[model samples]
Target: MAPRTPLFRPNAYFATRSDVLFLGLTVFALYVVETLVLFYALMYLLLDQIRDAPPALESAMNEVFSTVAVFTVFIAVVALLVVAAIVHYGSGGTDTDGTFADAVSVAGWAYAPELVTMPLSYLAARREIATLTFDGSDPATLQRQFEAVQQSVGPASFVILLATVVWSVYILAAGTAGTHDVDVRKTILPALLVGFGSFLLGVT
Candidate 1:
């Protein structure tokens, strides 16, 4: 189905059970991209400290940390669900009150904008991760490296992040309004609130 508004109403073309579809898309974001990014970053950190550490130990560490990334997916799923529940309750007085299932569908379909945004985001982030280099083997050096990663936000990365947030805000508002059977204005606050949450999580 063609989108009603390619720039805003990203979920307009979606059918039912949108929550599951978003979850699947999130797997690629959280499981694949997020997992590999952190895994490589962690290994990069341990390179010096574990210089003499056994290969088995490193592999074990990798296995352990991979679970951490997986846990982030769980957290995000819960957060999105919570937002959907809010939408259900908040839209109660509308002409057509939203059902819980519809709220979840809204949440899921809201993520549709990521389909267009994620590729650019992934490339920008992957490039940074790829070019990242650190010779810090000592605690002081490692600390600096860690800080660098935390603070490293170039213009391109910043632009991508801004784009994601802006796009997500509108798409989420559109999704919530359509799914809840309400005016778009009524959903704006909810969308902005959830958009902020996703931004903090680095998802949007």
Candidate 2:
């Protein structure tokens, strides 16, 4: 709960228009960078397949990339809106009154901590992938390398990863509570689902 991070008191801090705009734009920029990296990696993998492709086929491939890029950007915003709507309507029954705005801001701002967590998650994945690469397809050596990597996560990194996840989840839960004006007890399901979704997205 860093003071400047804004998750500590999401309800109070998000009241201003400027805060909402800033957080939204910052997260959006991060999302753009994330998508670019993913698509670039994808393109690298597909480059050889297209090297001898016909001119018409190359043009079609370009169009496909454009379509997918646009679709991903649309999903970037739509995902948050969907989460907001879900939490707003999904909260425990009637007396839970909160604005759609509150839910949207909370959903977007809650992902701020992913700036720290996703890279760590990505690196760990790459290491595991590296360990599994086959030089001779020997089962025993591959198993040993996999086990070594499974145990190789540094203690400090693990603690940091766990802390960020908890911090992010706490922010999500607190925001959900604020959104519903309900007790933490009522927000558990939404909190856990959102938190798990975030983790799954990052590691993927």
TM-score top scorer: 1
lDDT of 1 by residue, 23-134 (tens): 5345335434544564466455545443334456556666867786677667757866787776666665345555666666556555555656656765666576566655
The models' CA-based lDDT, in order, is: 0.60, 0.60
Tell me the tens digit of each residue's lDDT in model 2 across 61-169. Answer: 5777888788887887887777776666666635566666667767777667766566665665454444344322454654464356445555544655666767766
TM-score of each: 0.68, 0.59
lDDT of 1: 0.60
TM-score of 2: 0.59
